[model samples]
Target chain A: MLPLCISHGDLVKLFVIALLATTALAVASLFVGVSEISFFALLSGESNEKMLLVLGESRIPRTAALILAGAGMAVAGTIMQLLSRNRFVEPSTAGTVESASLGMLAVLLLAPDLPVMMKMLVAALFALAGTALFLGILRRVPLRSPVLVPLVGLMLGGVINACTTFFAYRYDLMQAMGAWTSGDFSAVLRGRYEVLWLALALTAAAYFAADRFTVAGMGKDFSTNLGLDYRKVVALGLLIVSMVTASVVVTAGILPFIGLIVPNLVSMAMGDRLRHTLPWVALSGAVLVLLCDTIGRVINAPYEIPVGSMLGIIGSIFFLSMLLRRRSRAA
Target chain B: MIEFSGVTKVYGSTTVVDDVTAQLPKGGITSIIGPNGAGKSTLLSMIARLIPCDRGTVLVDGLDVARTSGETLARRLSILRQDNHMTARLTVHDLVAFGRYPYSRGRITADDQAHIGRALGYLGLNDLGDRFLDELSGGQRQRAFVAMVLCQDTDYMLFDEPLNNLDIRHAVGMMKLLGNAARDFGKTVVVVLHDVNFASCYSNHIIVMRDGKLFLQGSPREIIRSETLEQTYGCPFEVQELGGNRIAVYYT
Candidate 1:
């Protein structure tokens, strides 16, 4: 008998359970906002128009944005991890988000009348440049220790963040920049969040190229030996990562740690074959953000906390625990 | 046949592999034995196209490796290097199945499954196929990597220091497996080995390298002698006949 870690049947069963859980959380998230939209009121055909308007204009879009942004950022993180061959590095740590914000600032200051899609494109370009810079620095650093990669990434992120902040303060756009950097689903009405669908499309693209990403993660030699164009795949992966991150950041602001934590959590349960684990990573990411958003809504009750703050608090704890756990294991 | 003509690799100011030109024979185990920094691994990598040569070219079955498409060359040749560190967690079965990626492109067919099974069985990993690579011992992991290379099923296979971390018994077993694969499949096996004794005992042909150059190439009997070994390694050495094989003992 093969010494299986988890059999095919078990994997399918687990996926089904995760799917059901995600559906339940998504449904529950649609009802937990400042405006009370009763599920039974819509079902029983009383005040149905008002409730439907609430659902369509606010609740549904919010829920969809949450799912798309969550899943997209998580998959983007996975791609970054694979491309950098470092688990702890993500967009938030590797200066991608800061660069995207810089692009958004550039667009807003230079051409405030541009369409949302144009803004996202500009942000994605900046993000691509930033991620490339991060990778360039990573190549020079001796990767004798794995933890050093993320440390360098964080330092790079700090530098970019400083530049962004200085500009935001100089132009007196700090308030607007603040709104773009902190995630909030309360303002996600119809047409405001459709750009996140592009993120979803990019995430789907990631699924199709999952195997190549896995091979690339093994190293350049492994990919070349397996007949894969390592440089081409890496470029495609970076493009996917940049676009997804820009879409999420443009639509719902920066969702921190969703990319860093979700993939790592899923890889712990399911192995790192992206084909098998990507869907779960997407689902789990959606579930995490949905849960956090719901909690942020309920805990403040009519006032509401931004999802970014909630995730920041939770994600930092998880990040610290992961670092400690890895250190202990190494010891 | 694998041919290297005036192949050279340079890093910064150092000439790592200095104009190496040699033809490795087909259908047998040819071992490259050299001391540290002697460019054995670099030469093997050049032949496999893992690294481009600063000058000249490598031809595999008359196809220039530098000009051939990666997919076409991968079907014909495969190479595994030392220190296969991976951030992603993979099972032995999954890792071996990747050997079929050149043909299947991530979609596994029945024929690919058969090849995977055969490679796993050849490496005595049938029962351990489902085990994660990190859960396995160093020797088991080495065998798993070898199994992956075998599953590639290329005409020419290159391994750079395959016995880096294995114990004596496993090292011997690994050499025997390479020998068997060469004989059974009629594949060309080129290995960079640090142990001269293993090369003398198991290899049909041996290439000696010294100071980034090919010093000698011949049958094991000619290359494993005391004078040739001492010249290549720049150390005192004694040669002995054991079981119809000339073994080099350098213990002072």
Candidate 2:
């Protein structure tokens, strides 16, 4: 009925568009640092020496990391939401973010000399455990009202955050926790940020596995009847979500609400064709984070706000507006 | 044929389906009717492997539902539950196209496209294919979901409360579609219905449940007696043959 556009070519077009948008934002981020580097300075490494070094080394990797992290987190959030059939499920809302933070704190205190991959693996495991626990509670709880599920998730996150904070304070690991809790792109230098590329691979995997995820969202009985391994898809989804969240957390710290807001926004704009919405979510996430980070740098001139803080405030406002709109429509 | 061998489902302490053994023949419309809390939905859910039975097993075409890989069984059976609420924005066509996911894995072939088109057309949803599901009314959304299930093109199609929220005309139309699917397409349709008259008119066989046990089951002609209806529903009912359909009058 929609003209049979479900093809590899359609995917190609979406990918190209998303890549173009992501690349343009990446280029623009190079000029958005404190020193106001120009395009020519970035290209030739010739203008103000301070601006050139910042542009070539710091800003480029930071921008790349932000794009990948934003895209990865949003796509992960989209998949989790689809599978869970809840709009509010994401790394931050589902307690995965706080769980990963606690895990990272454990790694920092216990094994300071551990490899970053090993640390990330530990964090991913922790996030997955937290996600599984959250889903377990959801299954047992009689959630007749759909809104209560997200409220329960938010409460779950609050409890986990309290636990994370207690540990953070007990071990004097608050400093490390603080650094990773609010997203900061400043430390994303070239060598430090390559792990974030794993998110792109995760995004690719999510696309190929989109059908299974969608089927799983149709509820357990319907999905099983259609011959989809419901538990496997759910497990795979949690795995991808945890890995992506951990990678982004380790690379750029925790970016709040970019995952939740971007996917919800894109789903509203164009229906959630996992094949189509994945790229849109990835692109819009890159754009939103890029725009937020640029604004954060420019708002205070020499002093800058962290992108995570900016997204937290902006995303909360947008989320509230959406809720109010839905409430009014229902009324 | 669908076979249930001592199928028992227990939710915690209560056994919802108690050692029910029945054989549903292929290529006929069968309706499961029961009172509230009678476990009709639980029974259908067990058959679809939506919920794992605590004891016993369900065999769809001799393939054990619990042991079969979802992929291997998806081509033969499909089920639609009662409440079909979703937040994802989707047009009718988009929802129907998802039926092909089992066969094509999101890569819809030409045959899959043709099936989607035909299913939509069969549901009389051709004109509203482009309309979003949320934009449609309750009956229309129900029809859209039915179209999606039909598009799945499985031999065994199960629907739980297919007439919920439908008006009289749409409800009649849905029953007719189920009857036609069983008659023309040779589909084995098992529907859980609340309306006795519609079930008696459209379905060849009727299974009744009460208090989590199979109370009675037989052909519609045998099960539509006045005493049977009154006993199953726990209400005084008068069944009269009107236009060759056993119409139950419970208005009193």
Candidate 3:
């Protein structure tokens, strides 16, 4: 009933705080790796080569990868929610990450000598196909309940994950390819993680067409009545979601919950207008992932747990509370 | 003028709208009253091009509804369907402003705001403009959607079951406003209604559809008679003249 309980100036300041937090976590992530590299050490010209190499090849790239994968996946989730008109949709809901993993497993078995970029393209293509399959199913069956879409998408993703696991085990790539498919930033180097920049680019494109996504989310009749090309806008949303998911899976593996939680949180605070909420979603996603990655890096000191494991732990609790919150709000 | 040549709509083996041809006169309240599954909503949806017709073509002012560009058709015609559910959290003013999207895209001009204000005033919704749609009751939300369509300022306006969820006072007010739009503004208005008495009172022309076909079409004086009412509804009816309006009672 109240129009924006939060004032405009306060919203801007909150975002500034988020940016500050993300920057701090990014800097902290640089120093928390196995090698001892601090900002003071860099200022003292102590890197000369080791710190410089660590910062350039390892730390900087990891931080950027975390931010890109986090921000991109979150935006993809937001767009998916808009496109499906479902608040619970995440990038992984459409089986994109599992499909990318399947593509990577196939490349590992069939074309072992291909470069990482080729593998990324293959995985992205597979993600697209998988996403198309899920969307096709959605169109065929009318939803009997609001929860049906997400449930179907989750089961679909599980089936794709089973296929990916079968291939990974059969090809003896379970351990070798597992690191890249499970949200580990340890493998990211300057050249290896460049694919995530493509995800970043697609997120920018989603922002450009934010209003179209918002209108299309209203339903087909509403969109057509407003003179918007509903099918085209929906296609654009699916494309953006698939590309973002694939790039993240190929580059940093499957980071969970960033998309589902970030967009919902932003929309709860700022409403569903894409332009206003997208920046906040991106920022919140980046900050959350940066913090999670930091916790993963420092939790064991010198040894790292994958960001996937960290998010899988923290994200589940967050998701449960969110579900409960929604129930309470509805009541 | 709107013309439908052999318009038919089907779902699987069931025909929702049988092949029919009719020319709707322009610039007045034309009420389409019919029994359930008589294809009233289907016919209205076809005119709006929200649903594709299986056969035939509908022409509005010489422009084919099926073939016209959405932008071109949107400027000339508008339709509000039943079951208006919106997922987005928008205020009444914001929802009404969306009417100008066909004209200004998302950008709001002074002229658009003027139309929005006038529509809100017309619906007695000026005080509720700042309230979110979800915060309003069902009747107010229904009125807000109707105001949005009115703000669109199209030549031909069509509404399907606009009185749903509305109480008697709002329902009468809505009908009077729609009738006035047809009379004072020279807008062609078509509405699908279940209440034949309301249709008899406000409509300049009344159409009765039965079993997916045009059962009858005439002025209220011609269509509200005992024989015509009984035949159209498959029930006995008592017709009475009240305040110069032919009111029908089909209690038997």
Q: Which candidate is the best by TM-score?
A: 1
What's the interface RMS deviation of candidate 3? 1.7
| lDDT, candidate 1, B119-228, per-residue tens | 99988899998788888998889889999999999999999989977888888888998998899889899999988999999898999888899899999988888889
**Candidates ranked by DockQ:** 1, 2, 3
Candidate 2 docking quality: incorrect, acceptable, medium or high = medium
What DockQ does each candidate score versus the true complex, computed on alpha carbons? 0.79, 0.57, 0.55
For model 2, residues B37-106, the per-residue Cα lDDT tens digits are 9999999989988888889989999999989988777888988999888777777988899888789887
True A-B contacts kept by model 3: 0.37
User: Candidate 3, residues B119-197: lDDT per residue as tens digits?
Assistant: 9999999899867787899999999999989998999999999999999999999999999999899999999999999
TM value for model 1: 0.98
Give the higher-DockQ candidate: 2 or 3: 2
Lowest summed lDDT across 10 adjacent residues in model 2 chain B is found at B85-94
Candidate 2's C-alpha runs over 4 A off are A1-21, A41-52
What tens-digit string does per-residue lDDT give for candidate 3 at A221-328?
A: 877787777889888887888778878887888898888888877776566777667888888788888888888888797788889988888877877787777678
Q: After superposing candidate 1 on the true structure, give the runs of residues whose Cα lies further than 4 Å from its correct spot.
A: A1-5
Candidate 3: stretches off by over 4 Å: A1-17, A44-48, A321-331, B127-130
Q: What TM-score would chain A of each candidate receive against the reference chain A?
A: 0.96, 0.91, 0.93
Q: Write the per-residue lDDT of candidate 1 for residues A1-331, one digit (tens) a residue.
A: 2234667888889789879989988998989877779988877777567788898999999999999999999999999999998889889989899899899999989999999999999999999999999999988867788888888888888888888889889999999999889988888999999999999899999999999999998889999999999999999999999999998888889999988899888776667899998998899889889999999999979888999999999999998998899899999
lDDT against the true structure, each candidate:
0.90, 0.85, 0.85
